[model samples]
Target: MRGTLLFDGRCGFCTRSRDLLARVDRHHRVETVPYQHPGTPDRYGLTEQQLARAVWWIDEAGTPRASAAEAANYALSAALGTTLPLRFYRLPGIRWLQEALYRWVSNNRQRLPGTTPWCEREPGTCG
Candidate 1:
């Protein structure tokens, strides 16, 4: 259940999110890495555009979860050690809802908590 969580390093919001994850992840099942870290994205076969679009998770077996919600679910599952909430994300109608919510938050991330002025001026140019 170990994995790497890739996020934007220069993004204040993303950095704060990573910190929160680190605090909650008492089991240490996940390791957070900034996409700008040398060779990090390349190791996971991730493109700049993909990194810009959403957070990503690469499992120990090299399986990737690109959707932000799905990645979050994986992280939370590892932290909480329960798959019940994750099951809801896979339900027929709920899946789309979860994605939509994630998208909405992602799209407005610059305006959300922990965002810096640089994040506001540039959407995803963090490096």
Candidate 2:
């Protein structure tokens, strides 16, 4: 299934994850877009607040499909042809744990290694 993963470009952790995913996506099964790009939010029918909260995944038709860990796992599964982790992600308690961890990382990413001061700003406009 062809899909797109929209992510926070200004974020060091997210950008690094995007790059790693690109390598895993050898067959080009998914497209990765940075939400910081012009019109990205509008194109995906997402609000800035939504994009800021978590990564997003949309099918080729551009319908909003999932967010946070769900989106990341879907994109990874699509690219790597690995359904095992995807299955793990659906386990009720595991899903909760995954989302909580994802939120913590998202919330603390600016302080992560490789992060620049640009990502530390509110509404980080520069990357």
TM-score of each candidate structure, all chains considered together: 0.83, 0.86
**What does candidate 1's lDDT look like per residue over 29-101, in tens digits?**
8887777766766778888789878888788887676458888878777666677767877889987888899
Query: lDDT score, residue 15, model 2?
Result: 76
Candidate 1 regions exceeding 4 Å error are 115-127
* Candidate 2 residue 27 C-alpha distance from true site, Å: 0.4
Query: What is the C-alpha local distance difference test score of candidate 2?
Result: 0.83
State each model's C-alpha RMSD to the native: 4.4, 4.0
TM-score of model 1 vs. true structure: 0.83
| 10 residues in a row with least lDDT, candidate 1 | 117-126
Clashes of 1: 0
Q: Give the CA lDDT, 0 to 100, for residue 22 in model 1.
A: 85
